[model samples]
Structures are given as structure tokens and as C-alpha cells.
Target: MNLSPKLLEVFTTALAVPADQITADLDYQGIPEWDSMSHMILIAELESSYAITIETDDLLEMTSVTNVVDRLKKYGIEA
Candidate 1:
């Protein structure tokens, strides 16, 4: 499946990157904009958008776009 539009929006907004730059290969620290602070912002945006609380373990595992999609899947959010 392709990356969800909502997921892409969250990434672009939180990381301040263009949508074209947010590929499946994108990972934490892969781009300068996706730093520590932005990660928290990403998490918050995700929580609010999906209406689910991401646990610490899941948070630690969300290192890449693919991984984030996987984590969201566990929450029943087909991202």
C-alpha cells in the first residue's frame, strides 16, 4: 500500500519538508529537519490525528516511515 495521505501530511507539517521528500526511506535523523524536537511534534500530531496513545515502546520503534506505518497498524490505524 502507498503511504497514507494523513501520515504524509503529518510528516511534512512536523518536519517542515515538502511532501515529495517524505518517502518510505525517510527515517529519523535522515534529514536535518527531522530532529529530536520535531519527533515529539510528530508524535503529538499522530496521537491527535489518529486518536490513539503511542506507548513508549512503539515510540522508540518509530524510526522510519515504514516503521511508523507498522506501529500505527498495531493501533488499528492502517497508516
Candidate 2:
């Protein structure tokens, strides 16, 4: 649970996945928990978590854990 609590909650809710399945190594593909609709849900979840917003470019670029973290940082979010 190294991720921000809000982020973690959103990931869990959007992907319908278990805590054990979540990690920095996890990506948006090759996993039953990830899909197109789930991706959109993840976007919304992330926006809500940071209490800010993301752009279409960032949203489409969110392919892995690192991407998510980096984008949050770009938004001046510490988590």
C-alpha cells in the first residue's frame, strides 16, 4: 500500500482487483483486471483521488504504475 490511500482505494474500486494484485510492476494490459472501461474508471478514480484533474494526453499515457505516479507528480501531487 505504498500508494496514496486515496489512489489505492480508487484502483481497487475501478479494477475490481485484490490488494495482492496491485503493485508498481503492474501494468494496464495482460491482466484480467484491466480493460478499456477499467481504464476510464481508473482515470476518474485518479482524478477524484488527487482532487484535481488529468488531461487526455496523460490519461492515454497511463499504461503502468510508473506512468500514474509520474503524472501525479506533474500535477504537483506529492503522492
Candidate 3:
């Protein structure tokens, strides 16, 4: 699935990866750039970009791009 430009920017900026690499299967720690350190950055970026406070439980569920998208759904977000 293609990501919205805003969502694409979040992944790219937080992970320091190319936009093309931000696929649904992009798993946490599955890539060198998306390691533990970057995961926290990614979470912070998500919160900032969406203006939503993610819960601790939801954080563990954010294992992949698809998972992040799903998690956002809980907040009534379209990304």
C-alpha cells in the first residue's frame, strides 16, 4: 500500500531511510536503520506528526509499518 505523503515523511525522517523503503512489511529491527534507537525516534515522530499520545500497550504492537497504520486507526487517524 502506498503511504500518504505525511506518513511517508514520518518514516523517512525518523528512520533515516529512503521513502521507497517504507513498506508495509518494514519491521522494527528488520533493517539496519530501524534499530532500537530509531524505533524510539519513530514513536516520537508518530506522536508529533499525528498529535496523538500513544499508549504503552500500543507501542509494543507497533512492529511494522502495517502495525503502525493499524495502531493509528485506534486514534481515528487515516494514515
By TM-score, the best candidate is 3
List the pairs of residues colliding in candidate 2.
Answer: none
Better of 1 and 2 by lDDT: 1
> Residue-wise lDDT of candidate 2 within 4-48, one digit each (tens)?
776777788988998777788788985887888998899888888
The lDDT leader among the candidates is: 3
TM-score of model number 1:
0.95
Every candidate's lDDT: 0.92, 0.81, 0.92
Q: Can you rank all candidates by lDDT, best first?
A: 3, 1, 2
Could you give candidate 1's per-residue lDDT for residues 2-76 as a string of tens digits? 778898899889999999998888899999998999999999999999889999999999998889998998999
lDDT of 2: 0.81
The TM-scores, one per candidate, come to 0.95, 0.87, 0.96
1-79: candidate 3 lDDT, tens digit per residue: 6788999999999999999889889898899999889999999999998889999999999999999999989998897
Model 1 stretches astray by more than 4 angstroms: none
